[model samples]
Each structure stands twice: as structure tokens, then as C-alpha cells.
Target: MRFIIQRDHLVQSVQDVMKAVTSRTTIPILTGIKMVVSDEGVTLTGSDSDVSIESFIPKEEDDKEIVDIKQTGAIVLQAKFFSEMVKKLPSDTVEIEVQNHLQTVIRSGNSEFNLIGLDADEYPHLPQVEEENIFKIPTDLLKAMIRQTSFAVSTSETRPILTGVNWKIENNELNCIATDSHRLALRKAKVEIDSAAHYNVVIPGKSLNELSKILADNNELIDIVITENQILFKAKHLLFFSRLLEGNYPDTSRLIPTESKTDVVLQTKEFLQAIDRASLLAREGRNNVVKLSTLEDKIVEISSNTPEVGKVVEEIKALSVEGEELKISFSAKYMMDALKALEGTEIKVSFTGAMRPFIIQPINDDSILQLILPVRTY
Candidate 1:
């Protein structure tokens, strides 16, 4: 393949695809980025088995030539070296050409480098997902949903299913839930769909994170296609495909408590900061547990103690406190994560009891909920 392309566009495309490229991939070709030059444009593809990303750059856009293709062909170049070389190229235009014996040459300004390229035919093909079940969501809302729930996915691989976020669509509403047995995050949104399509799938949290990072924060629509074992996200000129995690995700609906023993309303910022400060001491001890105790006159005492380290206690006046008195201990990190995800001026925390899981949600918004299992402090 031979093409002279704009340097800036080339760099952006390479960077976007690089998120899927990994040196640890067992397949040698998977570690490289595949570049295909055609009459329409230049397409760059990168895959690491679990996730695949393809970016296309048109030959000419808006009457300006972005790529001048001399020959229509394809080559797989080592992503590690190629990405670095493209970034350091001294000119605004980049020239790439391939010759016999899989030899590739890249030239820009006064610098030129020769790289050994692999036959693109050996690379594993991206999953061919037919347009069967498809849905669309706003880019900004999708990103927000990912941010609110992906963080709650388990980082451990022991329970592979828990490492992904569970997605369920019914009644034109999409519900996403993630939990690591200790803390859980759930977000629901209404979607536009023609058929009454109901789907329950678990998508890798890592894949969602990378996809969200690439998506722009706008109201533009993103097409989502779901197959048996793969899910495809189409955004403008990019196509992202991720393998779905096998096995049924545990039913988490039963985990949410129905009755509450105590319900307290507090300022989100104040509560988050108190937990942040209290966690400093908890971090020196065990699982970063912070304690919250309800006091008279609507005061909530947040404290943490470690025998070896100093203790911290802060009193924050609640907007209102009702029901039974409560004292609960939970992971400060988890609590802070939920609070940050639910960004609002006021929040209502409902405690089932001192031992049972408690929920933290915005006062006015019921679409998002965060639950944290209390830790026992003897």
C-alpha cells in the first residue's frame, strides 16, 4: 500500500486504534495495526482479540485532499514503532509506501524509516455482525451511563462475569448494573426502539471504558448492534467491536432492599468531602472503612479509626433525618466513587439497617442508584 496522508489525521486515527492493540497478544499479527488503502479512503484496524477498533479516513473531505493513494493495497505494521514514528514525523504530510518482501518505508520532511510489514491476510478478521438487533443512544448519555456504572465492576477475575456491566433492555428502557458484591451501581435510561426487544448481556467494563473515552460528549446518535457473542458500537467513522462475556450475570434485582430504616438527606459535596477526609485514616488500616453515625438535631458523624494511625471525625449537618437512628460502616473509596458518579447538589441515603446494604441516590433523580454493603467494625 502506498499513500501520502495528512500527518494530523494519521496520528489521530493511529491513536484511536492503538487502544485495542496490545503487545501481550499471543497472535503476533494482532500486535500490529492494519492499514488498507482503497479508492474510497484509508482504513486503520487494530485488535487484541477481546476488542477491535477500526478507523476510516476519507481520501478527500470538504474539497480538501486528506490522502493521496498511489496504490490500492493493505499492510500490517508494528503498532509500537509505527505509532511513535508517526507522532515524531517532522512534517504535516506523511508518505508511506510498500515494496517487495513486505518492506515498508515512511518518509516525512528530512526523516525516513524502513519497517518490516506483515501480510494483512494473516490477521484475524473482525467479527462479522449482521444488522439484526440494533439500537441507538445519544453519545453524551451513553458516556454518562458508562461512567456511572463501569467503576463498580469487579476488578478481580475470579468471577469473570462480575467484571462486566450487566445490560438489560425492556419496555423501551435500558438498565445497566454493575457490582463487586460490596458495592453496586445502577443507571437507567429511556431509549427509542421500534420492536419490543429485550436483551440481557454483559459487556466488559474495560471495553466500555475505552469506548467512552473515544466518544465525544455530544447529543449525536451512536448505533449499537448486538449479536450472539459480540457487540458493535458504530460512531461516525469508527467501528468498535467487543466480545461479550459468557455465562449469565447474577440477578441483582433481589439485592436491592425494599424497605428503609433510616432516610437522610445531605449535601453531596459536604458528604463526599467528609468521607474523603475520614478515609485518610482508614487507608492506613484495613479495607478503607469509614463509619457514619446519626446524631441528634439532624447531624451525621463521619469517623474512621486505626489503632496504629490517628483517627478522624467530622460532623456534617444533614438537611433532614427521619426513621430509626443508624450507624453504618462502609468502604470510603466506594462511597466516594458513588457520590462522584451521582453529581448533584443534594442526595438522599436510605439505610435498611446498620448491617444491611444502604443506597445513595440524588434527591430529585431516581434513575441512578448506588448501594454499598456495610463493613463490620468490632
Candidate 2:
């Protein structure tokens, strides 16, 4: 294989595929990136069993040449060394050539390096996902959905299913939900899709987090294809694929409470800051618990105490308070996370009782909801 490519373009493509390569992969060839040069362009692929990424750099885009292929061939090179070499190359263009016995040479400017390459045939083939069941969503909205729910996925591996986020699509609406048994985050958005087809896929939160990071915050639409066991995300010249978890995700619809005893509307920033200050003391305690109480004239009191550390109390007036006055205790960290995921200036928190799970959501938007299981302070 031989190719002379622009330095910056090669570096970006290497970085994108590098995210899927793992040093400790059981398959030896998985540690290397497969480079294929064809008449159209250059393609780089990297994979660990669970995830695979492929990036394409076409020879000419918009009548400009990005890569000039001297020969059509394929080879695999060590991801670690190759990525570093390409990034540090001091030149506008890089020339790569392969000789007998899989020996590869990379040259740019005054620097040249020789690297041992592996046969691309030994690398595992990427999973093929059919495009029959596909949908389109705006890139920015997709990233927002991932950010809002991925953090709530259970970190514990005991319940394997809880480590993934549940994604359901029906009637042109897409919903994503994640929970760790203590707190839950849910986000919904309207998308254009075939209303006759429905989808329920459980994608690992870790994978979704990586996908979100790679996606740019643009209005361009992204194509999503789902197969029986794999999901593919297509954006521009990049293709991202992830394996779906095997088990069925627990039904969480019943977990949200239907009634409330107390409801309060408060400024999101004020409440978030109060919790941030109160958490300093509670963080030293066993459970990092903070107490919230509703006082007369729509005042909300935030307080926390620790045996070894000092206690803290702050009062913030609410926009409106209805129903019975209430006091509840919950994890400060959970509250902070929920508050940060919310997008509105004002929030409404509904409590069924002191010990029941409470709901927090934007005042006028019903599409997104967050639930937190209160902690017991007594």
C-alpha cells in the first residue's frame, strides 16, 4: 500500500479511529488500524469487539485533492505508534509506502520512520447492519439526549442491564431513559421517522457517551440504523457501530409517581447553587445527604449536617408553592446532576410525600422528567 496524504487530514482521521482501538484487546490485530487505499479515497478502520469506527478521506472533495494514492492496497499498522507519528509529523503532507514482508515507511518533511505492518486480512470484520430500519435525527438534539441520560446509568455491573440506557421510539417521538436505582434521567424529542415502525434498543451508556463526544453540535441530520444486535450511526464521512446489550431493560414506566402532596416552582440557578453550597458539608457525611424544606410564604430551606463537619442552611424564595408543606432529604450529588441536565430557567419539583420518589422537571416542558429517590435522614 502506498499513499501521500495531507498531514492534518490524516491526523484527524487517525484520532477518530483511535478511539476504538484498545491495547489490551484479546485479538492481536485489533490493536492495529486497518488502512485501505482505493481508487476513490483512503479508509481507516479501528475496532475492539464491542465498538468499531471507520473514517473515509476521499481523494478529491469539491474539486480539491485530499489524498493522492500511488498504489491500491491495504495494510494494518500499530495504532499507538502510528497515531503519535502522524500527529508529530512536521510537514504539510505525509507519504506512506509498504514493501515486502509487510514493512512500512512513513515520511514527512525531514523525518522518516519505518514501522512493521500486519496483514489486513487478519483483522476481524466489522459487523454489518442493514439500513432497513433507519431514522434521522438532528446531531445537536441527539447529543443533548445522550448527555441528559447517560450519566444516570448504573456504574455497578451486577445488574448488567442497568448499565445501559433504554431508547424507545414510537409515533415520531424518541425517548431515552437511564437510572441507577437511585436517580433517573429522561429526555424526549420529536424526530422524523416511519411511524409504522417501532424500536426499543438498549445501548451501553459508555458507548453512547463516546458517540456523543464525537458528534459535532451541528444542525445537520444524522442517519441511525438498527439491526438485531448492532446499531450504526452515520454522520458525514464517519461511521460508528456499537453492539447492543443482550438482556431486557427493566420497565421504568411504573416507577414514576402519579400524585404529589407538595409542589414548588423555583429558579433553577438559585436551587442549584444552594445545593452546591450545602453539599460541601454533607459530602463529608456517610450518604452526602441534603435536606430540603418548604416554609411559609414560598421560602425553600436547604440544609445539611455532618457529625464531624459543620452544618449549612440556606433559604431561597420560590416563585410559587402549592399543596402541603414538605421536608425531604436526598443525595446532594444526585440533585446537582439532575439540575445540570435541566435546560430551563425555572423548575418545578413535585413531591408525593417525604419518603416517596420526587419528580423534577421544567415548568412548561413535559417532555423531560427527572426522578430522585429521597434519602432518609433520621
TM-score of each: 0.98, 0.98
Off by over 4 Å in 1: none
Model 1: lDDT to the true structure = 0.94
For each candidate, C-alpha RMSD in Å? 1.0, 1.0
Tens digits of per-residue lDDT for model 2 on 300-322?
99999887768999999999999
lDDT of each: 0.94, 0.92
Give per-residue CA lDDT, model 1, range 1-378, as digits (tens): 788999999999999999999999889899899998999999999999999999999999999999999998999999999999999999999999998948999999999999999999888889999997789999999999999999999999999999999999998899999999999999999987756798999999999999998888899999999888999999988999999999999999999998898999999999999999999988988689999999999999999888887899999999999999888899999999999999689999999988899999999898999999998876
Candidate number of the best lDDT: 1
For every model shown, the clashing-pair count is 0, 0
Model 2 regions more than 4 Å off:
none
